[model samples]
Target chain A: MAVSDEQARDELGERLRKFVGRPAAVAGAGKDPVNAPMIRHWCEALGDTHPAYTGPDAIAPPTMLQVWTMGGLSGHPGRTGAYEELLGLLDAAGCTAVVATDCEQEYPRPLRPGDEVTFDTVIEEVSGRKTTRLGTGYFITTRTEVRVAGEPAGVHRFRVLKYAPAPHRPHEPRQQRRGPELHEPRRHQEPESRRRQEPAPSKPLRPRPVINRDNAGFWQGVAERRLLIQRCTACGTLRHPWLPGCNACGGLGWDTVEASGEGTVYSYVVVHHPPAPGFDPPYAVALVELAEGVRMVGNVVGVPYDEVRIGLPVRAGFRRVDEELTLPVFQALSSVTAVER
Target chain B: MRAGERLEPLEIPVTRTLIVAGAIASRDYQDVHHDPELARRKGAPDVFMNILTTNGLVGRYVTDHFGPKAVLRKVAIRLGAPNYPGDTMVLTGTVEEVDGDTAVVRVVGANGLGDHVTGTVTVTVPGANPEATP
Candidate 1:
């Protein structure tokens, strides 16, 4: 199966070009998965023991090489996953581009564990930014195909978007623009001129687990079904939990309040199997944007064991994971997805 | 002066330049961490920092502060930015919260522009004497 830009748009951002074109050759593809830990993890996680993944000998995990299989960086000092190229494509084109917004993956065939993978990627569609009261955003769809021993293993679909000038209604007032102050320089330029010219070089949050303060309030609210975000009073930026100051504006004071919990499926993954101890398979991890402009990553639950779709309208439901922690899980508002593919 | 009291900014600050080798030590090879080509390609603006350096830097910050007596138990890092070569980052931690033998530190690093790493750290000494009792 092959995909192109036009084909992807028709399928609502499916079929990427990078993953197109089979090697046109295959050999000993079915006998590889006998002895691989990564593959075994996938099998245990998905609980899928297809023959290709569990033949005579053990094979690597189907998604085992994900960490090791990052392909060559095709540009200047590549970051992770050709991220620069992806972001650059959007930064130059879209006013505000976000990454990993709507990510979906599925396996058409099983990959043997020991079989080496040849990954290819393609672009599907680049949607214009959609505006909200906070700012405008857009979507970029990509397709990736994973091959082992030149055989199809799985397909990955990703949708990235960034909102600039947030997609507000035409009737919305200019003062209520979703983007930073109009007086500021170009979105990309403002940061370059600032002291923290680049996103603060990721330093260790600490030598140990320092609380992600930004999510403190959200975590605190997790105990309550009241999902809350830190709203900066100075610049009106909506941030999750609390931080010393705003990422957008250097504000110290913040107000924590409940989130509407009504949001679309921004990004999601079907964890075929558990990654650690005490985790069950057939669960979903998703990033949902509540009505209040902030995005939260939590488990997406309650759909039929299968059938979790993109753009699904979901609401927040909290489950206590620890005495002081309540995890946020999303259940479908209705069986129907907001914008069915 | 009380032990572990906040140190004021000395007029003449103590600074050292650490030359970190770029050889692969950990299993982590995220391209941006070691490969300059991969890093520049990924849109990092530049290679700025990694979890490993941050780990070492935190030890340096505390070792310098505690003079070998401040026992360190925990240091956590959630990588936010990429650390590249020829970059010197400053590690700074503040005693944000202090409890009975335990102290919670709010730590961050900067290349002078602003913070690159941000997180809290908790360190305990062998025998921490408190100022007041319960």
Candidate 2:
């Protein structure tokens, strides 16, 4: 009497469930104590200049709750065999690929510099098999408790999907296949027309900027082909994106200063997936640090997305994206203008 | 911190270097975040930004708008669209509720694909006055 496919699945799930409630890691210690260098590295990578993350009284960015617990490329010493055995079972069951899908963090108390961090992890749950754009897979969730000196500091809940790759359709070229999915529940159905590669229905207009009372003047400036930066009347500090008050002095009074339009690419990213309406994919968006010492985000024109790099000199240019929308974009300058800052 | 008050929108360009750098910074060595070739083999067109990076971006958006003094108490985010290189994620937030110095902000980070992250962040701003006019 041969076992049916359903029976095999049930057995596999049963074995997987046994791992739940079991300890995945016991008393894992952070490779380093909470410190400033790691925080600085994190802030630089994300382009975050928030002051609270630095100085003598600095605390790690609350979002970095998970970074301290990571074992890096070497792997964690406290990881028990149970977690690996669980993964081995999944691989044996043909679920070889994995992708992290979700994360939820709560900071009960800030992890300050010099706080020794330790954590414990448990396999919280394992979902039943389900089919997704990537293929069939199981969702595995783990909950971790982080502590400093045996005092609760934070909690992190993480989830991932382990699945077998969906077999490719023989007729379609690999490049034409859909991009990686972020696991949105409602976008399950791919329109037949899209799958057939019909001329993408007429492009949609660019998304309009969300203008409020505080930032309306900035948009007005753009319409007139001038890039404006907000200056605090009290502290003389310059800011961007038009806030209600000055971050430096908390002053409510402010005025506008026209930008010199000259700037350098402080940082940048290339957008590749979930194609934007009205724009082609793989365009470069740069964080241009203006000559006046304020930073603003805009498209880096006159260069391919791949060629856009840090320290690239740029000059602000206003482009009327649509009848109602005029945006400030940066024109990449020639190497002759790329002076080292 | 009045209810229904909206924060200025923040536009973040999703770049290749950011994706790889963020992954490395957070110790997330997932191939989908750095190795494009391996990512493609695993069924991704190209490497995508990891969730940790998205979380950090969201945190930055909130604190940037609330001023540098604001401290985050909790950030519970759910991922939607994948933030692929060459895209932008516009982060917008609304003050849903406020009590003294603490406020709960409903944040949504939308990219070209759609909402990349949606969650509520609890933050406390020292000496925040709810009666102050905008």
Candidate 3:
């Protein structure tokens, strides 16, 4: 964990230069689609089940508060998310670019289940610094706006220090806010109009499969339930998402296949960091092996936050992620099946 | 394309006949959906498919009817029953409403027995970005 002062400063400067002034906005305005159990898991992990967030009225999760602040850059696939594509850009530039060495949060809004939120974020500041262990790192300041459909949710500020000695966790600051969820469905416009007028300029026409009626079914399935994999009968191999042909056997003909929900954990990471949308911090994310023998990517849910492991078995359940898609997800096995290795 | 004019119907045939083929789906991972015993412990009356893994089925259904030009903007649904291994369910959608640059539709999934979920879907077209004026 020991490194030079100048080394850290230069690293921070490089990442800041890449994200400081850019903006990202999602096209086709709508809600991020809230799931009730996700909110419950979030609350259980972070230990913040405010009545407003879980009440029958249902409000959006606070982390989902970050929907739209990433202005004008949705056009570029690399810029769809404020920080995600930036990491790729940094990686391409030859920087290891690990995320925040440390962070702190202050909640301005208490979310109720089912409430829609619109968000926008900005790099509040960026600077270089040396850590206690002589590790040099860069710090970034981010601000996010949380809103409901067209209303207000909360505002959050995050500090990210990257490429340096890991910092210690700080005590969480407690705050208060309230609301209700059990209401008649209200019309929503999650993607603020600004997204349409603000696509970050990028080169057009990079050849990729065009999604028309023939392929609309694939995208439509994602909005519902069922994970569709391309099966190559020629070699008995499974393929990735939206593949035109089988990569395994060079099979000219292939068919779509579905998975049985049960699976095993391949690997897992406990998110002790800031919570992501519809997710609370301290949740477990695992690469589960589906019963089909095909390893798949998905989130593990409905278990104690403190007891997740590498080989813990799990099963699949689902929730409405939005109006069009039902998320295929997993829950931990109970009793002895739930016992960790 | 005219408003509410559905070019085709999106259908996904969900069957457990699929063979496992990667690091994603493994052996100990087998439960009733793959290994019935494991499925029971996971709080299910039976083994089912992970919702995310099955996303491609619904996506293919929409693309089959609409052509590759459609960009799926949003999807929302609730789980009605378990999708088991070998059993098949059909996922379907029909364009319900279209305003200016957007089309509102309802998508449903059905198994051999009957309907699973009947929900609404909204998609944005070339110029349907704006819903109203401030």
Candidate 4:
């Protein structure tokens, strides 16, 4: 039995490798032009203020490179069948789940306004089966060469992992006791009595915040109920949403300051649709501008969702929603302390 | 990880519009990317960016620094943090190894919260000095 299993795996690996150089997507010219409106929309979405993206001499934000080639809602027609066949083969092997692993891009030049974009993508590599925290899977990487007016301008390499969800490990009792953190919120929305009778299916954890050497301090602050902002020690420029370097002075040295927990809602939105596992619907999320002049995003609780608005005074507080999580939230100040600033 | 082979930092603004627009452009209709309330309901503080957008930004970061002549051969990135609106993600990379025409680069993108992306990108910089590649 073991020999047959190994043989089957080896056969599949050989098949997947055959697709390495096959065209995954061939985009047509100006399928979506690199235009000012789209660029403006992109800039507005990203809150990027670099002057290079604006005005008559504006260059498309190099990050917007792939946006120009995106097939949008309709998708592109040049996608060949080989990519799908490989996926189908994986699916047949019970590796039906998929997640994007990573991607890399290379630019030969900057994309400018009025530059028409096109590209042909090739399946670059497929890795041997491997195990990850998520599950057992194979990584598939693709390379796309982007062009302007048929000239090579950039290359985009994307990768994804197709895997089978690992069988429930009996040792992982913690996972079996409750659904993933993402689905935890839905349990709250449901009545406690109902939850006791019918257990929901297990859900994966909510997408955890990315933690690495640069911003681990901030997450540690979140755990401590202290909102720590990165301050450039050299320039004294306080920045939020923690950054590695100071935008004002390009300084890399930094320290942290605990926010006073005081701020006003700079902007907000109320979400109602698309039911998710952990969150209750129609909650208000705000861009709370701290007194320190930096902005942070969090849920505004302790007040009706409809009441959240621009300039509402709020105080930072911690919400311990799950056993493993404690997030910083904003509570509207009482009418007495609430002054429109 | 060569001392002299460093990529100039690139700044990417993370705005609500960006989180939503990137989702729309990539045809990712997941509510956590566009609907703030739903994202919160799903246990996120706000609408977080999708991987596709992050992937695109990484591509941009590399190409922007390597000039138009750099050809990305492979990009392998892993998500580290949730990039919510109101943060600026800074991307930095360093060439780790160079072999003939191809050079390997290690990159990390950090935001106010934490490292948003950490990965390795491989590229073939045609005509790049042997010292830069080898």
Write candidate 2's Cα lDDT for A78-149 as tens digits: 777888767755553446567677788989999899999999999999877665656556788899999999
Q: Model 3: which docking level applies?
A: incorrect
Error of 4 at A258 (Å): 64
What's the TM-score of each model vs. the native?
A: 0.30, 0.64, 0.28, 0.49
Q: Name the regions of candidate 3 deviating beyond 4 angstroms.
A: A1-15, A24-32, A46-55, A58-110, A129-134, A164-341, B1-134
Per-residue alpha-carbon lDDT of candidate 4 for residues B1-134, written as tens digits (9 for 90 to 100): 24359898988888887888878755466565787875544334568788877876776676667665665566667775568788888899998887776778888888765677888777666777656533
lDDT (tens digit, per residue) of candidate 1 on A1-341 = 11221122332112222322322112212222334554444344323344444556543332332222332222112122343333432232222223233334444443443555556555566554343322334555556566766766665554544433221123333344434322111222111232233344332211221357555565545544457778888898988546778899898888876776678778788877545543545667778878887887877654543566778887775543322334566756543211111
Candidate number of the best lDDT: 2
lDDT tens digits, residues B1-89, model 1? 23345633211111211212211221223443554443333334343333433443443354456443454444543333233344445
Weakest ten-residue segment in model 3 chain B by summed lDDT = B19-28
Instruction: List the global CA lDDT of all models.
Output: 0.44, 0.78, 0.44, 0.68
What order do you get sorting by lDDT, best first?
2, 4, 1, 3
Return the candidate ranking by TM-score, descending. Answer: 2, 4, 1, 3
For each candidate, give the interface RMSD after superposing the true interface residues on Cα.
15.6, 7.8, 20.3, 12.1
- Docking tier of model 4: it is incorrect
lDDT of 2 by residue, B46-71 (tens): 78888888899989999998898899
Clashing pairs in 2: A269-B14, A269-B15, A270-B15, A270-B85, A270-B86, A271-B85, A271-B86, A271-B87, A272-B85, A272-B86
DockQ of each: 0.01, 0.21, 0.01, 0.11
For candidate 3, write residues A1-341 as lDDT tens digits: 11222233354356556677555333323232455765555444323333445557765333333322222212222223665544433222222222222122223444555555465556666664423211224455655455556555555455443332221111211111111211111211011122234454432321232557445555455433446665777887875554555777677677777665667888887888774544546667778877776776666664555667778777654433322234455656642121100
